[model samples]
Structures are given as C-alpha cells and as structure tokens.
Target: MDCVKLPDVGSRSLTTALIQFGFVQSYPDYSLFTYCKHNVRLHMLIYVDDLIIGGNDTAAIVKFKSISIGASIYLGPLKYFLGIEVAHGPEGIFLSQRKYALDIISKCGFLGAKPTSVPIEQNHHLALAKGTLMENPNRYRRLVGRLIYLTITRPELCYCIHILAQFMQSPRQEHWDAALRVVRYMKGYPGQGLLFCSDSDLRLYAYCDSDWASFPLTRRSLIGYFVLLGQTPVSWKTKKQHTMSRSSTKAEYRSMVTTSCELKWMKKLLLSFGVAHDEPARLYCDNQVALHIVVNLVFHERTKHIEVNCHFVRDELQRGNIVTCHVRTTEQLADILTKALGKEKFAYFLGKLGIRNLHTPI
Candidate 1:
C-alpha cells in the first residue's frame, strides 16, 4: 500500500461507506461515526487504518465486525491500542502508557536515577535561564514530543510538559535537565494511569485555573483545565495564553472560556455516544473575580480589555450549557495543571483525578 495515497483513498472510501450505512459523522470529531436505531447505538472511532468499535448492543457489534470489508479484522477484546495499555476489571477501564513511559525513561538513561515526588520543582523558573543552546536540539525536541504523547494517559504531566515544550526551538542545558527531572519522576510510577470507575456517574464537570503572567519572558499567563465525566477525566490541557493578560481576573476568565468550549465539545461528543447531557456542566473556578465576570452582566467594563471571543463563556453560561461556580483554592483540582505543587498536595489531587496503578498489589 502506498503510504500517502492509501490513507486518503482508503479513509474516504470507508467514510463514504459508513455514512451510507446510516452512520452519522460526529460534528465535533469527524473521525467518529455513530449509529443510533431506537435504543441500540454504536460508535466507531477511526484512527488512520484502525477502527475502534464500541456499543452496548452485542448483536450490533457482531454485525459491524462482519461488514463486507474483508480486509478489516476483528481484534477481539482490546488489551493494547496505539501506545496505551487498556485493562478491564471490576473497578472499570484502566488506561496507561506503562511501556511507552518506560521506553522514554530508558531512552533518557534515567532508569537508575532517583525518582522525585513531584514532576517539577515548585516556583522553578525555567524560562529565565540563559545558557548555550544544545548542539543537537533534535534529541530534546523528540523527547519532549514523546512526553507530550505520554500525557494522553498521564494528565498530571501536562504543565511540566507544556513548560518543556516551549524550549523545543532552542533547547539549553537547563531545559534538558528539567526534562530529565520529569522523566525521573515518571520512573517512580511507571504504572500510574487514569481509571474509569465502574460506579462513576455520567455527570460532566470541569475545573479551570490560571497562573497570572506565569511566563516571565513573554508575560503570558498559563491556563490549565481538567474536565471530567463524573470522575473520569475526559479532556485536559495546559497552555500559555497567546496574548498577555493584564489582570488575574482576565487570565482566569480566559481560562474559563477555554474550558467552556471544551465542555460544549464534550457535550456534542457525548451525543454521538447516545448520552444525553441535558444538564449544565458544572464549571469550577477558584477566582472569585473571574466567576463574577462570568455570571454578572454588568461587568463588561472590567472585561472590555479581554479578547472578544473570550466572552464565549458568557454566551454558554446564558445558554444553559455550563454554570460557573466559585471553588475554594484548596479544592481546585486543576491547580496541578497550572503550576507545580508540594508532594502532599500533588498526591492529593492525583488521587482525585482517578490516577492509579492497576498493577499495584492491593
């Protein structure tokens, strides 16, 4: 099969066939196809040549596997897909990148290094460090790229990975060492992964927070969000704002807007799975000023300096898509994604995010 030609032609043909078979393409995610007939529903997610099919109807799933596409093979139950290791048990579905993470650790030659409790040191300023750039920066770029992929099952590494990724264009020794420290931390818990609890509710909620002007060089704030379907983390991100935020409220408000958009997307994605998310998703923010800006209509002057699109939060708020709520600082779970934390606090939030090691002995 020709690499370039196969993907375009094969995917287009498969997509056309799936559509003709009464499968509706997901609006938010085109690669996903959903089939809903009365109470029976099926969802197929396309990843290049791979197809992951799931549904509650056993007969429908069997019928899907026997499609006319003779080239498609049924891989029975899913134990491993891509780099992620999936395990099923009474606790629910456990997703991990144990092998992928270990490979990265070995690649960095940190297999014998001492493990740290936290991924990064608290208040550590990585951007201000000035030094000679590495001669061969591709190694650092490749390693950081791998670390970014590992975040799929390890959301706790999002902030540190985000910081390290910034230096990809011109990596220095300090940045390299910081990246190694993250690798060492991952060595401590190679098996740690997110667990989807069997008894978890279907309710969706999210936490959004920002570190105002966290980047000293650009004066850009760091925004991080974690969205959970019940207690299972479905989506999370740690990104630096494109533009500088003058006030902490604006930084936090921008964070809320990003999270609101993700929640709306999640709602639509759930619809593809036949899950009706009619209730407003709960949006938690520790900043009172930001929460006020979201709920109060008279706060226009304060947020006038903010980007026009940032007001999408307000539209979603009034449309009954999401409800902004004030959460105390101590209870903010998304804090881990915005900045580093102490060993104890970091561990506390990790447990709340449903990160665990299924390989550990009870």
Candidate 2:
C-alpha cells in the first residue's frame, strides 16, 4: 500500500470556515461521518484531516465510537437554520421565523406602533403622487426588503410587498405608512406560518388570476398564481405583467399561460422523482373568456393584442398536459395577491390558502 499525506490542522479550520456552518463532531475510533441519501445508507470515515465516506450501513462507525470514545452520537433535531424556524408537531412540520420579523420591525422603529387590521386600505388607489416624499428612502427600502423575505412563509403579505417594492426607488411617507401597516399586521400574526404534512398528497394544482390595469402609473396588469400540493400551498407569485393588457380576458389568459408553463415544468420534475399524476394537472381561472381561448383553437380578432407566447396555454391543453377550469371569483386563490380586498374577503381567501392562526392550536 502507498502512504498518503494529510493536510495540517490550520488547513482543516480554513476549510470549515469557508463552508456553511454545521455541526462538527470528532471521535477517535469512529472512522467517518455518515448520512442518508435518497433513502439509502452511506458512511464516511475520517482520519485526522483525510476522510472516506460511503457504504450500505454505518453500524461499524457507531460501534467503534461507542468502544473507543465511550459516547453515543446522534445527528440532530435542528429546528432552525438561516432564519427559517422549524417546529415538528403531531399535525405536521410548521416553519417560520417570527424573531426575524420582530428584528425588522424594531430596526424600522415600528415596535410600539398600533396594529392594523388590513395591510392595504380597501378602495384606496395608491398613486405615484400620494403622500409626502420621505427624507430617508433607505429605511423604507430596508423595511420593504425584509418584508419581501417574510413572504416566503407569509403568502398573505405578497400583495403588500409587491406594492411597496415598486416604490423602493423613491419611497414616500405614504409608502412608509403602508409598510408599517404590514408590519403591524405581522405583529398580530407573529406565530402564523406555513405547515407541510407527511400525510399530504403530492398533487400539482394551480390557480391563476390577473387584475386588469391595476397599476395606475403603468397601466400594467398584475398576474398572480398559487400552486398547491393537495391542500397545502407550495409556490406562489405576484408580478406586474410586462405589457399592458387590452382587457381583463387577455390579462387572465396571460396569467393562465404562465401557470401552464409552471405546471409543465412541475410535471417533468415529478416524473424524475418517479411520481405520476393519474390525471392531467388542473389550472383554475376566474375568467371564462380565457378558459374558452385555451380550449378553442381558432384565434379571434379580439385576441390579436395577446402575444404569441401567451398562446402556449392552448398547446398545453391540446397535449392533455393541463386542464383549465373556471373557479368563482370568491374562490380564486390568486385574488388575494392580484388586488386589494376587504377584511372579510381577505380573511376568507386566507383560509382558502391553507393559512390558519397557529396561536390558537389548530
């Protein structure tokens, strides 16, 4: 056998510092680190700075450490990492980071602020000229930035975040107030977050909707979607359409096209994981014209304004890769993100999105 040289202690510390932080355990007799990959067992043995990791089972490493190190080692119950708080309960695994929200609120000097019931006022049309200009735009920008990050687990705030994000270049006093409204809303829903269950059926279902010419300044429509795996939401988005839509029907069709592309990608990904869908994926849209456009092949004169790319939904329908169905406006999951809603309607849609008050035990 040939002799191999290992790196010194200094080199090991440098390598660890360069990598993302994780637990490090040292055992004299244990030859390697072990972990599971794709539900298969694997192991790695380390000798000083050198390591060798693999195998079917790692009982030898555990037994060796038990005899030589006189201690039993187990991996982790690591609940929180990278601002994502994790909790495992009988219902499922709940994930959120309320502490991070508090930090942002305090940093923005809104800790003692009064709570607001709604994030954005109903029937209030925010324009580019509303409210006095803010002297320090950076503070408002930072606050909105933090809130955008919070949307990862708080889909309820997606609309508010999108509106505030637009004013980042020149946030005014009114924009700051709107930002605070969201923060106050967070204060009330501190414990609220997302839950993923072991019992959930991994079905790909999506709902897409758009608000026609919702942005007064740009005359651009807002397109939004909510993708669900069974009853739990897995992905969502609220974005201003790049081109101005001529009518609500055109806007809704554009949104459907976007959702169809997402479903197609998801179908391919699911196939790679060996999961097959019994039926074509379903997409819910509130607009009847858009649904008709998707199912019908002929293009009418009214649809000339729609871009060619937006016609992909028709192809997807032809391929039997997706089925578009009509959902009532009240039941549209994307409605919350596309436009401002009343308190009752907002709460109703929130419930529809699988969000619940965690403070009152499920």
Candidate 3:
C-alpha cells in the first residue's frame, strides 16, 4: 500500500485509476463513480481514503472488492461513515449524527440547558444585531462550522446556522448567545435525522420560496429551496440573494431559477445511477406572480430590469425541464428554511421533510 501526502496529487491519481477501471465519474458530484452494464449497476462514493461501495448486483460488488488496489479493507455495510451514523431497517436507511451533536452540546456546556422548542426567535433580526464583539471569535467560528456539518442530517438547523454563519469574522455577544441557543435546541432531539424510504417511486419534485428584503443590513432577500427524490430529500439550501429585489415576485422568480438549476443537476446525477427521470420535474411555489411569469410572456416586459440570465426558469419551463405549480403558504415546506417559525409551525414543517428520531417515541 502506497500513501500520497499531497492532496492534489493523490486526488488526481485516484481519479485517473478509477477512470482506467471503466468507472465513470459524476460531473455534478465529483466524489461519485458509477459502473453500469446490462442489468448490473455499481456505485462508489469516495472521500479521501474512505470508499463506500454499493449497488444491485452482489457479484459485481465482490468483483470490485477483489480488484488489486494496494490493500483495502471492506467495512461491510455502512452503519457509520465519518460522523454520520446509519441504521438500516424494513422502513429504509436512517442517517443521523447523534454522537457529533452530543459532542457539540458537551463542548459548549449545554448538556443540562433547557431545550428550546425552536432554534431561533420568530422575526429575528440577527443581521442587524449589535452587542459587544466576542473576545475569542475562534470559539464562535468553530461552533458555527461544526453546526454547518451537522446540517447534513439536520435540515431544521439550516436557517439558524445560515444566519449565525454570517458573523463569523466578528461575531458579537448576541450572535454567540443565539449560537448557544441552537445547541440547547439540539439537546431536545440529538438523535433526529433524515430517513430515506425503501419504497420510493424515484420521481423528482421541489418547493422553493423567498422572504423578500428579510435582511435589514443589506436589504437582500433570503432564498430557500428543497428538492426531493420521491420520499427522500436529496438537496436543499438557504442563501441570501446577492442582488437587491424591488418586489416579492422578483425574489420568488430568482429562487425558482436557483431551484431549476438544482433539478437539472439532480436529473443528470440520477441518470448516472441508472435511474432515468423521464417526466418534467414538479416545482411548487407559493407566489402566484412567479408562476404566472413562468407561463406568460407579458410579465417579461415588467421583469426586463431583472438580468436576462436570471430568467432561466422560463427557459426551463419552455424546454419542459420543470412544471411549476401553486402551493398554499401553509403547505410550503421551504418556508422553514427562509425564516424562523413558531414551535408548532416549525415542528409541522420538520415532520414533512422526512426527519425522524429513532430514539424518540413514534
């Protein structure tokens, strides 16, 4: 077994060998490699020296394991990878970072703190908070950074983490307190995680929303979108828009464009896995004006001020890549990602996102 210390050279060498072995790398996510032939299919997810091998054919997996690649140890079925703990059952695969979450609580001295129903207060103006600057910004940054990784299995933490992450350079006391509040919330359900069901139809659908001018400091809109593969959530994001929006319609339109790009990439990635998405992806938005803009040309005249490039949602509609639909505000799942919500609403949205905690009663 040979070890390459340089990350760049090691990654390049590994990629070259995998390509030579007839495995096609995924362009959307470079860490993924797939091998498909006839009725057999194989997938390998690589992260540095660790590799997860799986697929339909058991024989193909054994064949790949026999390949001469220095010395490798098969870890059997994935129960734990990196910090993520996986539990497989009749329902599906359950993924969580319980140990990691507990470690954060222990480190922050929040193990005994009372758990809050919500991570953040509703209508929080975190961006405009003013207080004493942290004497040790390193602690604040480290906590926020770890929370960011914990979001892999805890989607409910995305919005609060996104807000806290902005003050990394010079976090104030208020920001630090907010970060600790999140830790307290984690104490309530440290074992909560995402569940990928076994019996899914493999269809693609998405919900997108925007909170117009939500950030008081920059007056920029907050955009959030969630993508699902049948019953499982494959991708989601909450980001502050770069450009200022004059109207809520424009903000929602920009969010749809962002989600359309994610849908296209997800489609290609699924194809690599031998799953073909033949139908137009369903996109749900609560804004009527944005839905109208997707199907009407007259709205274009009013939105001409929005950069031409930002109108790609319309192009995707025309190309039949995605079908837009209207969803009531109460039913929008992405709403939690865009703003802070009350306990009942937050818990309601969390349940819809396929999040479950095995340690808690059903």
Candidate 4:
C-alpha cells in the first residue's frame, strides 16, 4: 500500500472501524495474536479528530496497533494528539495548549492589544440600549461563540462570558465593547488554564445565590451556582431566571431548588465512581429568608404562591439529603456569578472562588 498517497483525513473514523473489525474477526487462529494483560484499565478518549490512548497495557496496545494498521490508516507516534499539548516525563504528563491560545489571540487581533487586569470592569452594566447597535450581528455572534469555547478551560471568565452571550441575537455596540474587554482579559492570561491536579481531595461542595429582579428589561432575577471538587471549581453557571419572583426570598428559594437538583445528580455520579456520600451535602445560601422558608415546616400565607415543584428543596431538607445554611453576603463566593459588582468586590469574589491570575509567578 502507498501510505504516502492516503489523505490525512478521517483518522478517528478509521480507528473506530479498525477496532470494530478486530472484534468481528472469526478466525480460529486468533490465539496466535500477542496479548498482554495488566491490572490498570486503559482510557481512550476520542474528540473528533483527536485520539488519546493511554493505559498500562503496553503489549496489548502494540498488538492493537499492529491490527489497526492492516485495516485502516495509521497516524505516527502521538506527541500532541489534541488541542491539549502533552509533554511526557518521569514526573508525569504535563498538558497545556499554549500554541492554541496564541493562535486564538492572533486570529482575534488581540495579540498586540493592551491587556486588562479584569475580564469585566467593576460597576459594568451592559444594557443593550446604552450603545450603538452592531452593523453585523453575525460577526458579534461568531466572536462570542469562539470566546464561549475558550471558557472551557477558563472558568474565571465564565460569568463575563455568560453576560456577553445574552446579546448574541441582536448585539449592540456596547455588547461588542464588552466582548473586546473579555479578549483583552484573555490576552493578559493566555497561559491561565485549569490544572487537573493528579492528586487532590475530591469532596464535593456547592454554593447557590440569586439576585432578585436584576435585569432592567425582564425584571427577572439571576440565579448562579458554583460546584467545587475540593478547592477547585469543576462546574458553574450564571443565568437569568425563567419566571419573575415576587420577593427576594422567593427568588432565592427557587435558586435553592435548582441547586438541589444538581446536587442529587452529582451525588449519583459520585456513587458511580465508587465515592459514597453518607450524609447530605451542604448548600450555602446568603438569604436568611430563603433558609427560613426551606426549613420552616409550617405553611404560611406568604409562601402559598410558591409552586409545589419549588418546594423540592424543603423535601430534600426534610430527608436529610441537603442541608441549607445562611452564608454572609460578603463572603458568598456565588455572588459574582449572580450579578455585576464594583471592581474591588468583583476581584475579591473572583479570588474567593479559587480563580487566580495564572500569569502571576508562583
């Protein structure tokens, strides 16, 4: 076979086909193939064109590779398989995508732009009416989409990205300006990426908060939740509520309900991984009224309008599966995810959430 003439394409598809073929082959001489067994389970991750194969079974892998070459195209030895740059060493595998970051920066025309210390300015409220509308809304959408992808490894900018994404359909000039600020922020922290430490405590903790009637146009509160695996933030979200809440307490109660659902799923996932939660996970909320509502067994006049579905928090609390506690507003790390704040407060909250400017030297 003229291997050089084969186009550099469909590597992942070809690999999958080869694996399937190996499984289907009915030859009785299959025992002749070399096989190695190891205690460690191998992990093979396929992300479109990128293939990551790692395990302790060296001999089995060699045999698989030998069969793979006969049935499909074979790529050379893997160094940097995906956007995640891989560096092998005695210490361990060091993964980063500095080149990817540089390419994004250059393509966005932010390579020479001045770097900003913050992703979103303190006291920044980006309403659509304040500035001129964008002449090309599609361009704005494309930029926002790319930035959203970048946030996969940059949780520090998650809130800002959420805020900017709201204006994707009919972006205004102010929206574009806000998006540019994010690019500037990224420029300053190009190498700032998530570190999946090889060894760390995996205890799960969650914080939830709501800003009642935050949007000027919709009068809807913003609900935000941050879930942490030990000290590192693994998942988070900042989004506007679907329905308007009559009071701050009701808004917060609704936020609690949302967080409870997530906690339930997370607990199940952890169990699948062989991690058991003997006790209910703690949920920290800054609103005292919400906490009271969740714990209060008595149904009151003020709580009548709250839907039955929203009382899931109360049921969970009663079951001892979720414990709700009042957290001080100033120390509430989820506050940044709920609304815009002054520069000093934003930076303080960002730091509290375990988001550090990685550009700073250790």
Estimated TM-score per prediction?
0.94, 0.78, 0.95, 0.77
| Residue 48 displacement in candidate 1 (angstroms) | 0.4
Q: Model 3: which residue pairs collide?
A: none
Which tens-of-lDDT digit does each residue in 1-362 have in candidate 2? 01122345454553353232221222322333334445544344445544343344456434323332212233234365456677778888787777887787677666777767678887765565567889989988878888888988888889878988988888878888888888888776766788887788888899999999999988999999988888878788899999998898998999998888878876764443446776888999999988988887786887776778888998988888888889998789899988888989998888777786566411
lDDT of 1 by residue, 1-362 (tens): 00111133477788889898889999989988899887878888778876777877888887777666635666667777778888888989899999998899888888888899999998787898787799999989999999999999999999999999999999999998899899899888888899988999999999999999989888899999999998889999999999998899899999999999999989988887878888899999999988888888784665677777988999999999998888999989999999989999999999888888766411
Off by over 4 Å in 1: 1-9, 299-301
Better of 2 and 4 by lDDT: 2
**lDDT of candidate model 2 versus the reference:** 0.73
In candidate 3, which residue ranges exceed 4 Å CA deviation? 1-9, 299-301, 360-362
Worst 10 residues of 3 by lDDT: 1-10
- Displacement of residue 346 (Cα, Å) in model 1 is 0.8
How many Å off is the CA of 211 in candidate 3?
Answer: 0.5
In candidate 1, what residue range of length 10 has the lowest lDDT sum?
1-10
lDDT of each: 0.87, 0.73, 0.88, 0.69
Tell me the tens digit of each residue's lDDT in model 4 across 273-306: 3467877788999999889988887979999999
